[model samples]
Target: MTRIFSLTCLYILFLLSSCSIINWEVEPDNLKITYQDEELSEIFHDHILRFIDEAEKRDMTFRSGKVNIKWGPELANHVNATTFSNGIIKVNPSSVKINHDHLSLQLISHELYHLLCQPPSAYDHRSRHLISGTPYVSSLMVASSKKGEFPTIDNVEMWEYYFDELFLHHGDYSFVYDYESNSK
Candidate 1:
């Protein structure tokens, strides 16, 4: 059974990878590290902890018990970071360009916030009309930062409107949160 399950997982991963809209390549080891100065790392760590604590207060659980952050210079400027269901968040090592010491800690929190408050499924919920009924908890992160504000609550509310229109004819909300969507 274990062998069968492993093979099944591999097959599913292959399918998902092929269907992914974001095409990201793995970074080489030598270029994979972003060495932040002591001060910046400390500051970034504080923010990250705060984000996690806030989520916990709301009874939210991360897809992965631990969030993994990595930095590599090969990433493009447009690419801030991407969060996978498996709990990996990769940031551009050279994101600050000149000031590597000032890592985008809020940006890191923003991405993790997305993971913590993901719509439960990959199916775009942007069309749901639930409005106040469907809230994106991460929106609160916005109030804390000017640069890496989490997705606006208004944006999420609009997403609810669109989701309902597309998925359900009525305003009834029906669906299961899919945490296994990216399970390996």
Candidate 2:
């Protein structure tokens, strides 16, 4: 029966991976993990805790109580990591399986940066959102980079987009770019 249950779970995970939208599950302690995987479940939990530790060590304020971390095959193809401004981080399990401290730290810092900047709403109704927040949390990391608060990503287009929003939110200033001119 155990073998059959495990097989059934694997099959469900297989189906989820092929879906257009990833499914999220609520675990104990109000923690949210993306997708389902019996094999990688423990490892995912450990990494979330470890990422929070690393974030705190770096002086980053990461509120794990309100964030969803996804490290299962539900991630889009060829994607290593991605985050929603509202506090969902999608990562590839293979990216964290190894003990590469640098990669792990960078990714953790990046996601934690999102949680700190935008501030996620806790799942237990511990907090409330006055307004709908922004999307594309990665771009906000780029905004922080402009102020030397976070690391800059290599994606120029995304970086430019976030900078525009941040400045507009700050003061009466705007910057425009000719994408066609820079495309080449």
Candidate 3:
């Protein structure tokens, strides 16, 4: 009788451990991310957390849904990233340079902007017009460089400007010509 009881207790403990392991494996976080390369995973994850923190600082709240991100195939027009309405973001790995932290943050934050902002159109640049000065595009949503490049920010001030433009500004003042001139 003692032997049987001891074996039964061990079996029960094993079953409990197994159940917890399964739960941990299947549980989904707010952001369900998949990366093509394991080395990029941690870097991207840290950037994402920073993005969320910045958004919250601007009083922006994300809707309740698990955003799924994955490394996707080469995007059309050499874009670095694309976000879908259904909370999916695909990053083009080829466009990302592993050692460029600023560029990587920009790419991830740009896509997160799309996912969280849900602008009227996927291509909305949220351009702000000047009443009397030269019109310019300053938002992060503005099209990227046509040569598969993004403008490098030389200082923290420029980075802050882009972040503010993305989170605080609204309305599109882009002319038809602006659309053709900008590339993403």
Candidate 4:
């Protein structure tokens, strides 16, 4: 009886997972507009501008930064944003599905970091040398522990950490933040 019950439970879980509505496909140079919502686009644009402003103030090289954003359902099993090589960032628009402005600036900011540091050409071998301080494993751990809430602490740390690292790569990193405390 116990074995039978366990199998039944497993089947139920599978059914639930299959029924989930979120799905998306990321393609090169193409905007996958999920849910086809116009209002969400405007709201995301405003936040993107704010992110650009902050990025510019920190580093002038990114002053002319522009990114293509495509909205879609929170398709990834993990509720997060991603930047593709084609200079586009994909955002899970579920939070804004109800309240258009409920989006988080941190999401856009984090992905923008990826977009900026991307290699200018496919032939640039140095692109692989750059590191994303927020490792996928750590991000997965924090995501599972919080059950989909934003990692405020990690987000803030990443902002400073990535900036310092980026500056250091260019040499003369006097402007970079001291990472002594990060050791803790």
lDDT of each: 0.43, 0.43, 0.60, 0.44
* lDDT by residue (tens digit), candidate 1, 10-33: 999999988674323221111121
TM-score list, all predictions: 0.41, 0.33, 0.59, 0.41
C-alpha RMSD for every candidate: 13.8, 15.9, 11.9, 16.1
Residue 40 in candidate 2 has what lDDT?
37
Q: In model 3, where is the ten-residue run with the lowest total lDDT?
A: 22-31
Summed backbone clashes in each candidate are 13, 0, 0, 0
TM-score, cand. 4 vs. native: 0.41
Q: What TM-score, to 2 decimals, does candidate 3 have? A: 0.59
Tell me which of candidates 3 and 4 scores higher on lDDT.
3
Off by over 4 Å in 2: 1-35, 38-41, 54-64, 71-78, 93-102, 118-184
Candidate 3 C-alpha lDDT tens digits along 1-184? 9999999999999999896663222222344555556655765777777677677677776542456777767676477777887777787767744357766777788777776666426446544333222233455565563322344546565566556666765443343234335432
Q: Pick the candidate with the highest TM-score.
A: 3
Model 1: lDDT to the true structure:
0.43
Off by over 4 Å in 1: 1-40, 97-105, 119-184
Candidate 4 residue spans exceeding 4 A from truth:
1-37, 63-66, 95-103, 120-184
Point out the worst 10-residue segment of candidate 2 by lDDT. Answer: 123-132
- lDDT tens string, model 2, 1-184? 9999999999999888876352232222444455445543443455456444433444443344456656546775455566676666666765542244333434544554455434445211111111112222322323222122222345446444434433233222222233223444
- Per-residue alpha-carbon lDDT of candidate 4 for residues 1-184, written as tens digits (9 for 90 to 100): 9999999999999988985632222222222223235764665655555554544555534311346777646567465555676656666756442242322544554455456543434212112221224322122111122222333434656544544443334322332223433443
Candidate 4 residue 178 Cα shift, in angstroms, is 5.5
Top-lDDT structure, candidate number: 3
